[model samples]
Structure formats: structure tokens, C-alpha cells
Target: MTPASPTPPDASRRSRGSIRKTACCLHRGYPVDQLARQCDFLEVAYIMLNGDAPDEASYQTFRETITRHTLVHEQIARMCSGFRRDSHPMALMCALVGALAAFYHDVLDVENPQHRALAATRLLSKMPTIAAMSYKYTIEQPAAYPRNDLSYAGNFLQMLFAIPAEKYVLNPVIEQAMNQILVLHADHGQCASTTTVRAAGSSGANLFACVAAGLASLWGPMHGGANESSMRMLEEIESVDQVPAFLRQAKRDPQAFRRLGFGNSRYRHRDPRADILRETSHRVLAEVGMSDRLLQVAMALEDVALTDPYFVDNGLSPSVDFYTAVILKAMNLPSSMFAVVTAVGRTVGWVAHWNEMHQAPLTIYRPRQIYVGEGYRDYVSRRGERSAELR
Candidate 1:
């Protein structure tokens, strides 16, 4: 009876149990339930990997530290000028993430708890700078320096679009929208890329090396790649009238329609998060006066799909990505940059999870497999073995 497939293990026994024991990256004993909602990506990240939310003082200090490091070091700024404008932002993002390793090689080498804490601090501090610089260079703009007084989201906004010719005024709505998206994407129990980060970090690898591995995993289309897919789907439909026909085709042949942005995950019927993002999309779309045919089409499709029995039974719904793409697109970001935005928000969680694994009574991740190959044959002399094998 296959040994009755072993009983579910306790969270406290993660170190002793086989890797297949857990369903996802979530450490069962950790306070994942408290964190999966209510916290922003940064806060949840700190909680998961660090085992506690930052107290007011720590939160303030960490926020300040991150703000201080939000602009690229001048050397990185110079190097970025080398890439062509048409290059994909992810290529530049990967290079920049790796470049950070060079900047803090000494910090990474420190093994003391205090020193490791500083390394974590530096990484959290520098992420926005690295992400912002990548965006600026890809668009051929002089990097906007980070402002000390602005909120974390505000500073990222400035770095992305502020120009020498004009002062960049921060908009409250846009910043809130960005923060919401970041919070929603903070971490997913044990996602593929996050698992990659943990596996790489397991050997006591430095944070940069681990984060690079995570970024590579995020580059897969089924994961972060869906952000671009969401935008493209909206564009393909192009207007409200097309929504019904598209819905009909999709319903009649789900294989043919596939509902690009709407149906990807376990929370079928409608993502609670989608309602929030949809509001933001509307606000941004109206702000930008973008009355594109695609927007109308997407809205129409959403209306039908939300009411459709097909989607309800299937446990599929428009995800956070669907609304997020429209909001970002309205804010003037290219689809290529969508996943990078996801990566930036996710870095906080990634680093935190890496830290969490370190504090755990450490286990090297090794999954087991049943042996299924043919039984081994006895060794023999080359020619003798060949003749005897047939018999």
C-alpha cells in the first residue's frame, strides 16, 4: 500500500523531515497566517525571514536606510550608459543585480551576526536604486537622484520619470496604487523563484548570488512574465464591442480563448485583490485620459467573465496582474518593465526569506526520489559482457 503515504508532519520538524514534507516554501511554524495579508511586501518580507515585524524604531531606521541608498552609486550609473535603449529591461536588471555583488563584496564576506545584519540592511537599502537606475538608463534619461524626505514609493516614482527640465511632483494616488501592487505581490507561500533563492542561499552563498538565481526564476513567463501577458491581452482585444465575441469564443473553446490575464491561479471566481487593482486602474486610466479601444474591450470581457458559470466552476478569475497592467500602462510604463516592477517589490520578500532560512536550525534542501530504473547488471569484461547480456 506504499506505506500509507506518511502522515503530515509538524511545522517544528522541518529540519528533520524530507523536503517533500511541505507543500510550499512556507515554514509551517512561522507566523505565515498573520502575514499573508495586512502587511506590505517590505513588512511581510521582514516578518517571514526575520521572524518579527520591525518595531516602530526599527521600521523607521530601516526605511531611512533604504531611502539613503535609493540612488545608484556613480560608477554603476556610468556603466549603465553602455547598454542600448532597445535592450530588454530584465537583461539590464540582471546585470545590475549582479553588479551589486561587486559593490559589497566585503560586506558579503562578514560572518558575524551584526555584519550580516548590515549586509541585509545594505541590500534593502540599495534595491530601489538598482531598479530605478535600470529604468532610467533603458529610457536614456539622466538618473533622478533619490529624495530624502519623500516616502519610499514616492522616491521610486521620481527616479523613474523626473527630468532635468522640470521638477517631478509626487502624486499621492499613484504612490498608493504602487504600494498596493507591491504589497499584494510581496510573497507567495513557496513560489518557484523564491524556492530557487532558498536553494541557492542554503550553501551560505552571499545574498547577491542567491538573489540573482531568484531573478532568473522570475524571468519565466508563467510567473512574473504574466504581467506582460496581461497587458498584451488587453491590447489584443482593443475595445468594448469585441469583449462579447471574445468571451463567446473563450467560453465555447476555453482552449482557444484561454482568458490571458483573467484566469491563472487558485483563487478562481474573482481575486479579491483584483477589485482593489481594478479601482486603481480606473483612476489611472481616467487621469491619463487613455480611452483606448483595448481598455473598453478588457472591461467588457471582465463584466462577462465575472458573471459566467464557466469561470465560476473552473476557479479562475481576473488576477491582480490583469488590473495591474492597465494601471501601469496608464502610468506610462512599457510592458517590458512590468516584470521588473514585480521583481523590485519581491526583492524585499526574497531577502527576508533568505534570512529566515539562515536563522532556522539550517537544513540543506535535498528532495528524494524512488529508484525506478532497471535492476543493475553484474559487471563483466567488455566483449564477454555483451555476449552474456543477451542470454
Candidate 2:
């Protein structure tokens, strides 16, 4: 994996097939490696996934574009208004995403090129709104509408907590950290969720339908649920003192907690993004004055696991999930909200990929497989007795 050499847009467009993988990150292009070196991950995602690198103006425009879509729909907000304040944020998030599918039914019903572009724009814009609204609803707060004038990061912060008394003053460090996280997590080529998006899109399902398919894939514990599970592991340790032993036990029997985070992919020995996120988590924890003993334990566990041979043998590295919990918790967000935040940032990449697919004229994907079962069988009527040999 290396930084992408400068190539003409047409050349790059044609280069896609040389890179696409059905299930792994692009089997050919190293978008993550290229992104990790130069541009912020968000911008790289827009380019690599969307197929065009946005200039400064375009970047600002899309930033504003996403912000403009962050407002909660009046009807959806009303529906959620009646739910218990203590209900999990993910529950509200799920409903909000589904409601959005209904709210944009007009676009869903239209299939023309212009209509597809419009729907793409609408979905890209509105995802953050739905995610932010879910958080506000969980807290039973009056949802703050999107302020068009704010930068994407600023606007998202405002939507999450809008009142002046407890206003979110954007910090450069935290904003950069969040942007990095978005960048790193944006598009792992043909990840389970991305594949879901492509599969549904291939069927000519509407944009929302495709997004919902991706969301369902993300809901699986083996995928997006890893972040939530990682945090839970931290909670289980409870203190720095508990970390070494936990790692030893985990090392002692890797399969015992194979279900946990830090050891699934066959890529890097450690997820490359973890180092940056671990630093960001430390900075955030220090800045926010959050010193959960659990966080300390998480850090210690990270150290032992990184050095341990068993983890190294398994290609187990601290993934994005390992640090997301700490970062979100430090930001005062509950565990349930992390996945939605992940979705909000990711929708940009999803639309970009969808748009790219539309341009290339892809047919509905249908792969063939070998059938190993008996090739011929006789049909038996209810009134007829089957021969013992046939049975």
C-alpha cells in the first residue's frame, strides 16, 4: 500500500476494475494507505470512494451540503417525542433511519438519472440530521436545527448539544481527531456493510433501501458491533491493575474471548489507525477531565495485547472499535451512539460509491456456484408410492 500517484481523472476512472474486490478492501488499490499519508481520511474517502477528489471549494460545499441535511424531520421528531427518555439511542437511531426511508419516498420511487443524483444528494445531506436527532431524542432534549452557516464539524457539534448554556465550543484537537476517525473508518472496500449496499443497489432497490441493507449488515456483532463490544471489555476490566491479568487470560485462551475485539483481520499486525486513535483518546481524556479507571485499564490492556505473541500470531491488532469507545465516552456520548456516529460519517462514502457504480453501468450482480447435490430426482405424487430403491 502506497500513496496514489497522480493520474488523470479518466485514467483513474478506468483504473477501478483493476482494484475492486468482492469482499476485502479493494484488492488492488490501497486507498487507506494513500489516505493515511497525505489527505485527511474524510477527503480521501470522498475521492477514493466517490471517484473525484474535491477541491477546496468542493470540499467546503459538500461540508455545507452535509450540514444542511442534518435537521430532524418534524414528523419523525414528533414520533420519537413520545418514547421514554431512557430508551437506548440506537433504538431511536434505527427508527429515525427507517422514518427517513418513508420521508423521502418520492425520491425512492423515482429511478431516472437526475432523480438518482437528487436522491444521492438528499441522503448524503440528511444522514447526520437523523443521527444527531437520535441523540437529542434519547436525552429528551428539544432537537436543535442545523445551522447552515457552520462548518461540518461545528454544525455536527451544535446539533449534538445546541443550547448556549451548555454550548459545544469546537476544539481543534477534538475536531481533527473526529475527522481522522471518520477518514479511517469511511470505506473499507467491500466490507460487509459496503457489500450490502452494493448488493441492494445492484437489485435496483432505492437508495434508502440500499442504505438500510448496509445498516442491517453493520448491526451484526462481528462487524460494527465490535466498537460497542470493545468498550464493554474495558468496562469489564474496571481498573489499570486488572489489565495485565486480563491480557494473560486472553492470551492463555484466545478462543475464550475470540468473540471480543482486537483480533479478526488478516491485514496489519496492528490496525494502523489504532496508534493515532490511541493518541487522540489520551488527548481527549486529558482535555475533557475524564479519568475513568476503565479508560486507564483499556490503555493498559492495549499495551499488553500489542506485545503479546498470541495476539501477534492471530493478526489481532487494536482496531478502530478499541479506541472509539473511549473517545465517544470522553465526549460524554453513551455507548449506543457510537455506531450511529460511525454511520453518519460513512454515508458520504456510501453515496460516493453508489454514484460511481451508477456511472459505470453495472448489471445486477449474480454470481454462480457449483451444485454438489444429486442432479436428477423423480417427482412422486401423493397418491403414488415411491420405490424403496428411489427412496
Candidate 3:
């Protein structure tokens, strides 16, 4: 008998996993880990914006351009004042970014490459300033102006933690940790917020508006707020002795336990970003002399979870959000500001996605939805006769 002919591959199923499979950054074809280790956030942003690492002259020019834009428009400061003192930073950030379109209408043209570039630069440079302002506004502290003399991360630290009399000294170890956090979060291809940016940009909206939409999406607990939730969970555990009980509860009713940041959607074994952050968290905690009982609890919990067959079978590994919570807490950031920091780091990614979508052959994004409801029904007007029938 003749051998059976080979069956052709299914075209419909071929692209099912393509989105996750192709998610990556190819800055000069370097792996993301290499980029995160070798470059600062400014250098990473340069690569994202210009598609390559900059030479000396180009690096100076780019750095200067970013530094010049670091100071937000004064009108933006006034707009931030409108928010209530108790407002969430993420909510304030979402509103402020949307308001940027009104303040910067002069550069709102997506079709003009120069306008797009300008918007990207302004958003990338000023996000930290905006985020810090939101934090200051909540505490009724005067906003600190951006100091161009500091590095990007240093400037943000100064703005965030500075006060009236004392001069804020930037610690080298904390600055390095902050840079690593920013670079690690700078981009993750087509994540929820990035997709939101692309979808809004597809409608030819202004760049700031597109990013505002992305910010709104990022505010969801499942996306950018995971670290905040993780930090809260660790606090609830309270100590290493309590970790086993929490794990038992988690295993009993997963919904009740609500494991906030254990596993990632993309990485089954380990998130590469988590590896860098885990080490950084230890180093920063050691250098900063911050006592974090939660970090100890988290480590114990991770040990318990990893050894369990249930967690192992389900691919439950610590993700970027897990270690990030510890690091940010060690840095003295409140849990509420955790997501805002993520938003600040991710602004460059959102702008880059918006720019890329506009530069391509543009098409409005409209996804098809399955109709699961009743197909058709007779129109019934709420008139006298219908009212009598209902009665």
C-alpha cells in the first residue's frame, strides 16, 4: 500500500498564538535582558524612539532634548490642582494626560512626523513629573520642579521625595535600581495598555489622548495595579509564620486567596524581568537599610508555593510584579503609587506604539463580536395600548 499523504497545516489555527510568540524588542537586535542590564532608562527610551542606540553626539542631543521637556507646562500644574486631595494617582494621571491634548494642541497632528516626534519626546520626558505632581497634590505638598542637572531617574527621585529645606541627595544604589525598574518596564510588546494606545491611535486621535486611553486601561487591577495588590497581600500575610496559612487558604479557595502577582500570562517558568528585579530588590533593601518584613514573608511564601505540586503544575512562578512590590516599598513608595510608577515607566512604550500605528497603513480597529442574544424581536412601543397590556 502507498504511504498516506501528509495533511496540510491549518491556516486558521496558525495565527492563534502569533501575538504572544512575536512579542519582543529588537533594539539593534539585542535581547531585552542585555538592554536592561547595559543601558539606562534614557538610553533605552532613545532606542525605543529612534530604533537604535545613540552615538556620543546623538546621545547628548537626545538627553538634552528630554531634559528641556522635563518641566511640564504650568497650565498642567493648575489642572492638577483641580483634583481632590484624596484622589488616586492613577485617576489623576489618566485625567492629566487627557488634558495634555488640550494644552498642547499645537502638536496634535498625527500625520506630521515632526509633530509625532515632539509629542513622544514631551510625553516621555514629562511623565515622571506628572506622576510626582499627583503624589504631591495628594499630600498637599508643593510640587518640586524638575532639575535638569540630575539624570532622568535622579530627577524623578528628587521630585518625588524632596522637601522645602533639605536638599535631596540621590543615592547611587537607589538610582541604579530605579533605572533598572524603568528599563524593565519601558516596553512589553502589545500588552493591554499598549494595545489600548494602538487602538485609540488607529482612530486618528491625538497622541496624548491615545496615551490617556492607555492609562485608563492600565489602571485596571489585572494590568498595572498588580504590584500594588501584591504589596497589600504581603502586608496581610504580616510575617513568615503566616505565609503557610495564606498558602493553605490560597490552595483551598483560590478566589478567596487572590494570589495577586504569582504567575504571569507570558512566562511559564520565570519572567526575565523578575530575575533582574529580584536581585535589585535584595540589593536596594540592603543598601537602603529599610526593614521589610513583607519581603521576608514574600520570600517564604514563594518557597512554599514553588515546592507545592499544585503550583508547579499550574506554572506559578514569581513575576515582575512580585519583586517590584518589595523594591518599591523598600524605596518608600506607598502602595497606591505603585501603579503610577509603572505608568511613568511605560509612557515611552505607549508613545512609541501610538507613533508606530500612525506611521503604518492606518485602519480603524473594530473587532467582531459573537451575537449570543436573541436575534430579532417585534418593536413594541411604550404607548397606551402597550401600557394596558403590561398592566
Best by TM-score: 3
- What is candidate 2's lDDT per residue for 1-391, written digit by digit as tens? 3545496433213224213232234312554544544565445645754466789987776665555665656887788777788876666665666667787777764347777766777776666667777788777677777778765555666788776467567786667666666766666555777777876787677787788777777767677777777778778876787777787787667754655767545454555566667777888878877567767777777777777777767766676687877788777777777777777766756666666667765567654556788877777657675554367
Higher-scoring candidate on TM-score, 2 or 3: 3
Write down the RMSD of all candidates, one decimal each: 5.3, 6.4, 5.7
Q: Candidate 2, which segments miss by more than 4 Å at Cα?
A: 1-45, 48-50, 82-87, 109-111, 164-166, 255-259, 366-391
- State which candidate, 1 or 2, has the greater TM-score: 1
Model 3 error, position 231 (Å):
1.3
Quote model 1's TM-score. Answer: 0.82
TM-score to true structure, per model: 0.82, 0.81, 0.89
CA lDDT, candidate 2, residue 306: 74
Model 1 stretches with alpha carbons more than 4 Å out: 1-55, 252-259, 369-391
Give candidate 2's TM-score. Answer: 0.81
Q: Which whole-number lDDT from 0 to 100 does residue 54 have in model 3?
A: 89
Ranking the candidates on lDDT from highest down gives: 3, 1, 2
Kindly report which residue stretches of model 3 are placed more than 4 angstroms away from their true locations once superposed.
1-28, 253-259, 306-309, 383-391
State model 3's lDDT.
0.80
